[model samples]
Target: MEYTELKVWKETRLLVNNVYDVTKAFPKDETYGLTSQIRRCVVSIPSNIAEGCGRRTPKDSIHFFHISRGSLYELETQLYLALDQNYIQEKEHKVLLDQIIGCKKLLNGFINYYKTLKTKQTINH
Candidate 1:
């Protein structure tokens, strides 16, 4: 399946866009610090998913999905840090948190679905 067609990818893609929009108001000093870190982490979530979908083997694809999950966790942490540092307002933080939570659930469902298929393939082999 094309990664672009997947709801998980689409949602994560929106999350990335939101991150970019929200991070713009951060302090200038954070441009190379918290801002860059958050951007990298958020970007990886969707990029990894797309990369995984391009892989020929199910195992390879699943591995990328795992990486994508890790990135999501990293982004979640960064969002909290952003809140604590006052880079984002409470409402903005809540919005981003909601988006991240939704993306994580969708990504988890996709990963579980692929894992089940992998298990069935292993059994049939």
Candidate 2:
């Protein structure tokens, strides 16, 4: 199963791209601050998802999913900070935020699905 085939992964990838694009316009002074932190957190979301897809066991994969979820929340907080700092305009903030929220929901759904699968596997084994 290719990671790109997962909707959650694909959506997170888009979110990461948006983060990179917007952070490009941030003040140079924040180059090593919020900008760097945001880039790392957003990248973690999809990167973890992809890594999870390659894990040898369902349980192992789910661990990566949890990591990805944590990264998403971190990204959200950083985005809010960016908004408060006026690094991004309201319109840009809204669009990026909406995307982040949607991606988070999708990640949650996938996590639940995988947990259920692991439970069923345990019961049968």
Candidate 3:
């Protein structure tokens, strides 16, 4: 299946939208600071997933997936920073956290699936 069709990728895409929507209310001064950083981290999640899917080998795919997972964690931290800075409300922060948790679970499963394929390929060879 195309990476875009994957549940994790789809959910991450939604997260990108939700983040963009929320960040719009952030201070104008943060436009190039936290805002930009958050945007990049969120975009990386799905972009890396797509890149991984395009890779020829399972190991190569897993590498990109790992990067995506790392970005998700980074984004999670940034969300907390946003909350502490009062850039977002507790309710909004909770929603984003929940979405991140869901994406993490799905991405972890996807990574494991690739790892199994890698193991099988190694055994077959």
Candidate with best TM-score: 3
**Candidates 1 and 3, the one with greater lDDT:** 3
For residue 64, model 3's alpha carbon misses the true position, in angstroms, by 0.4
TM-score of 3: 0.99
Candidates by lDDT, descending order: 3, 1, 2
Model 1 Cα shift for residue 106 (angstroms): 0.4
Candidate 2 yields a Cα-based lDDT of 0.91
Q: Give the top-scoring candidate (lDDT).
A: 3
Q: After superposing candidate 2, which stretches have Cα over 4 Å from the reference?
A: none
What does candidate 3's lDDT look like per residue over 1-125, in tens digits? 77778999999999999999999999999999999999999999999999999999999999999999999999999999999999999999999999999999999999999999999999999
Cα displacement (Å) at residue 52, model 2: 1.1
lDDT per model vs. reference: 0.93, 0.91, 0.96
Locate the minimum summed-lDDT window of 10 residues in model 1. Answer: 52-61
Give the lDDT of residue 90 in candidate 2: 89
Q: Write the per-residue lDDT of candidate 1 for residues 1-125, one digit (tens) a residue.
A: 57799999999999999999999999999999999999999999999999999987778889999999999889989989999999999999999988988998998999999889789889989
Worst 10 residues of 2 by lDDT: 71-80
**Position 78, candidate 3: lDDT:** 100
TM-score on alpha carbons, each prediction: 0.96, 0.95, 0.99
